[model samples]
Target: MERTVYEEETYVGLVVRESKISVNSSLEQDDNQLDFDLKIIAENTGDMLIIASYSNNTMGENEAVNESVDISNLFKANIAFRYFNGMVFSCSVYDFYDQMPLEAKIEFTMTKRISSSVTNKDKWEMFCVFLDETRSTWSDAGMVTTSYSLDQVSCYSEHLTSFSVLMKVTTDNVSVENSETLSLMSTVCV
Candidate 1:
């Protein structure tokens, strides 16, 4: 019983490339369908393809997970265990050399950058917080599902680990290349 192959590192830009492909970690469709999809195929590195999917539905009673490292069922709600009401890291960035398909989101924010006389900026809003390093505390990540199009931004995670997207910046001259928040991270060569 030896099947050990786990690697994940995908960062596009600034030259850090390594593409490996391997799929089928209990590839679910039905039969309880507690999906934990991980698709990391960044091979050849042309045509620019970026896709990340980690899902769940929750159903646990026996307890024994290790399908290439299963993060249980994340979190939907927890009584003792059996969690999974949300978890989706959907990212899509297809730039066939500026063919256009770049608006994929992965924002982790601490929010700070507003100085143009501070005009309120229509009450800025952007939230997706969850950082409970054991007990440091920072709640509210019960996002069952969130979707958006015109480039793509689908954040559906009831719980994971290390999360931040809490932005409430009052618009005013916020420059830094539009506040400079662009992310695309991946790690999976397992």
Candidate 2:
């Protein structure tokens, strides 16, 4: 038996993070542990990656059968990153070729610009979002669009000024594929 294969493109929605930074401070505390948790959201876009696998079979007169299987599919996801400096980073569609059958996850880290006079007391916060396509009407539209309220932060003290933001993304079942099948029939008369 033979099978037909097809590829389809999908679009994912936007992911949003409430807050990217958390801080703790005490007047009389000598030692403290700061916990920073960031939220990440991924949208479902039709433009995901997909792969296909198939096998072929053959039969011989000696009542023996042989089979061969191979992979024959590939897909890519395009992601764009925007920074606070009005700078944008573009990631091209990467092939979803892996040993394990799972989705692809992409992570990004950004460094915050700080002045030399800044000290430890000063606090800094940053966040990031992704967009599918570029928009010409508005600069923000080109971006996946992060909330200002979510990306906002206040400096605790003037001592701390320099900081950086790291963004992580995970996608599930983005790549899909089908397997091929083959059948053989043989007869012998003595």
What does candidate 1's lDDT look like per residue over 1-190, in tens digits?
Answer: 1123222332111111123222222212222122222233333344443333333313231221112121223321111211122222233434446545433223321212322332444333333445445655434446422532222223434333433232233334444443332211112322
Off by over 4 Å in 1: 1-78, 85-94, 98-102, 105-190
For candidate 2, lDDT tens digit of each residue in 1-190?
Answer: 1222322222111211112122111111011111222111223222222222111112211221111111112121211112233222222221223222222222323222423332343332233333222321112111221222222312111111122121211123232221111111112221
Q: Give the Cα-based TM-score of candidate 1 against the true structure.
A: 0.21
Q: What is the Cα root-mean-square deviation between model 2 and the actual structure?
A: 26.6
Per-prediction TM-score: 0.21, 0.20
Clashes in candidate 1: how many?
A: 8
Q: Model 2: residues >4 Å from true position, as ranges?
A: 1-83, 96-103, 114-125, 132-190
